[model samples]
Target: MGRWMKPEVYPLFAAVGVAVGVCCMQLVRNISTNPEVRVNKENRIAGILENFDEGEKYAEHGLRKYVRGRRPEIMPSLNKFFSDPE
Candidate 1:
């Protein structure tokens, strides 16, 4: 068989894998540290909290629910509130 199509494609595959891994990692980190995104998330949380009384347990309950892989239904309400209807 010709060398170009041979089974020695390991190095080429590894190079492509490494490049894709680096790009994904950088993208995740960049998004995690974005200030505007963070602010919007905090504002959403605040909006959710508005339905509760002062010093209520809703915040803690939300954290627990989110950690348990549950998305609250109130998310749509918050999104609708924040979204521009224009």
Candidate 2:
């Protein structure tokens, strides 16, 4: 009916708690830094190639159209962004 106050039992509880905390921290750290989380450019390109079709555009052009509104066009805005050679 009473809690265990034996001198030896306190250390056992403390040890178990520390071990569990360490294991949890390790799990969190590992999950955050997992190497398999990044996107693979080659795989993305291969997927697009697999679904290749005539008259279809590249992803960059598709993205430009989606953001800027209209059919996909392949003109780079870099010329406008950079200063003229004059």
Candidate 3:
């Protein structure tokens, strides 16, 4: 309803949505990386005290693994062109 909605409240709604998304992502990350919360049955049998290293490895296996060894440049070619001696 046009009468019920205010343009000024839109930014607040957007901010709240973003915050909720961030919180959900953090919750998922925490659950996935928690050593005690094993998803696999075999891992559950192995107990919480063990396989901490494996959990750490699992946490690092996605984008983090790929980016870990990469140069921290946004535009490597452009940077190289500027830095190179004529």
Per-candidate local distance difference test: 0.60, 0.57, 0.82
Task: Enumerate residue pairs that collide in model 3.
Answer: none
What order do you get sorting by TM-score, best first? 3, 2, 1
**TM-scores of the models, in the order given:** 0.36, 0.37, 0.52
Top-lDDT structure, candidate number: 3
**Better candidate by TM-score, 1 or 2:** 2
Model 1: worst 10 consecutive residues (lDDT sum): 50-59
The parts of candidate 1 lying over 4 Å away from their true place are 1-6, 36-86
Best by TM-score: 3
Residue pairs with backbone atoms closer than 3 Å in model 1 (clashes): none
Candidate 1 residue lDDT tens string, 1-86: 47666668878978999999999976775566433333455565754333444334423545576667655555876787778475
Q: How much is 75 displaced in model 1, in angstroms?
A: 53
| Candidate 3 or 1, higher TM-score | 3
TM accuracy, model 3: 0.52
* Candidate 2 collision pairs: none
Residue-level lDDT of model 3, residues 20-61, one tens digit each, is: 999999789767876767787887787647666877786776
Note the clash tally of each candidate: 0, 0, 0
